[model samples]
Each structure stands twice: as C-alpha cells, then as structure tokens.
Target: MILYYALLIIDPSLIGIFINPFIVQFTIFTRVYFIACLLGVLIPGILFAIRSIKSDKPEINLQGKLLLIAFISFTIGALLTSSIPQMTIKVIARLILVTSSLEFYMGYLLPNWVKKILLKNDN
Candidate 1:
C-alpha cells in the first residue's frame, strides 16, 4: 500500500485523470485503495467498537458507541465528498468529516466533561 501510494504521489497520472481543474475521476488504483482502507481499517474498527460496547464497563460502552459513530460518519463523509460533484454537498460532507474527527477524539480520550455529561445521563 505504501509503495502504491508513493507511486501515485510521484505520478498521479499513472492511475488518475483530471476531469476538470477541480475534479479528478476515480481510477482503478483509487478504488483499490478505498477497498483496502475499508477492509483494513474501517471493518476492524467497527468490530472493535462492537466488542467494546458489549463489555461490562459503562465507560467502555460509551467509548465504543462514540467510536462507532466516528467511523460511520467518516465513511459517509468520504463517500459523499468523492462521489458528489456539487459544492454544496461537499460542504455538508466536510462538516460530517469534522464531526467524525471530534467523535474520534472524544472516544479515544474520554475527557472529564464529556464523561460527566454522558455518564450522568446513564444514571
């Protein structure tokens, strides 16, 4: 994967073509990369989140849920950004990407304020 990405960085035209100044059509290599990411990262992440959610600890469960949301939102955002041509839809996708980043941060760190608010709701 690293080699493939490196090659792409060195010569983007080897796998991709610019539709216009702003848009690049998806290529076979790009599709393969997306598939690799989905299988390698997203699927495993979702599985881990599910396992965590099933744990006995409330904190773990909350973290799992947040992580799950983050993963799902990130996927949605990426797909929307790549597939849609409209600028407006792209903006919405970027917002979802930002939300996913925030969710991932909260899940990984579980800050005191977030923990208090989330745990308070459970009680």
Candidate 2:
C-alpha cells in the first residue's frame, strides 16, 4: 500500500474542490514518485514508532506535535491563499518540506534502524 501510493504523483495538485485532498494526481511512471513521496512522509513515523516499540520506551509525542504544527500551518496557509496562487504554492511547498525533511533524515541518518524494523518479524 505504501509502495503503491509512493508511485502516485509528482507535482500532486491537491487543490481541487470535491477531490481536494481526496484524489491523487498521477501518471504512468509517476507511481514511483508518489510512492517515494508517501514513504517520505510516513516512513519516519513508522520507524520511530517501531523503535520505541522495540525498546519498550515509546516516546514520540514530538512527532505528533510537529505533524499537528505542519497540518495547521498548511491549512491556515492554504486558506489564506484563497486570493493568491503564489501563496498557495508556498503552502504546498511547506507541506513538501515537512515530509521531505523527515524522510531524508530518517532514511539517511537512521538507515540501519529503519532496515532492522522494516525487515523484522515479517512472517
């Protein structure tokens, strides 16, 4: 499921009315991009949660807080951008920033940890 979503869309235009935040803009080969993007956004959360689970010391309240901040910032920014296209773009860019940063840091700095959990107990 994560892999499928990662290969979804490149420049996802999640700004439509009825389809807003509901539909994914994708292409043929773009599935990989969307999958990557999805992984970028979620892999961090999964890994963090797993590590805590393994250590028996769950403590990622900060992730939820940061995620909440990101959501609030994106929502407010997009709402304000109702009158400006550039501002809307800025809001989307910020959303991308939040996820991409999480992905890169986790995938890079904590590669071993992610691999260990991702490969763990998959029967």
lDDT of each: 0.85, 0.45
User: How well is each residue in 1-123 modelled by candidate 2, as lDDT tens digits?
Assistant: 544444334333322232355333334444445445455655665555445445432223333444444444433443333423454565775566666556445543455565465444444
6-85 in candidate 1: lDDT tens per residue?
87899988667778765667777786777677667689889989998998988899999999999999988988877777
Best by lDDT: 1
Pairs clashing within candidate 1: none
Model 2 has an lDDT value of 0.45
Residue pairs of candidate 2 with colliding backbone atoms: 6-34, 6-35, 6-36, 7-31, 7-32, 7-34, 7-35, 8-34
Where in model 1 is the C-alpha error above 4 Å?
A: 2-11, 19-22, 121-123
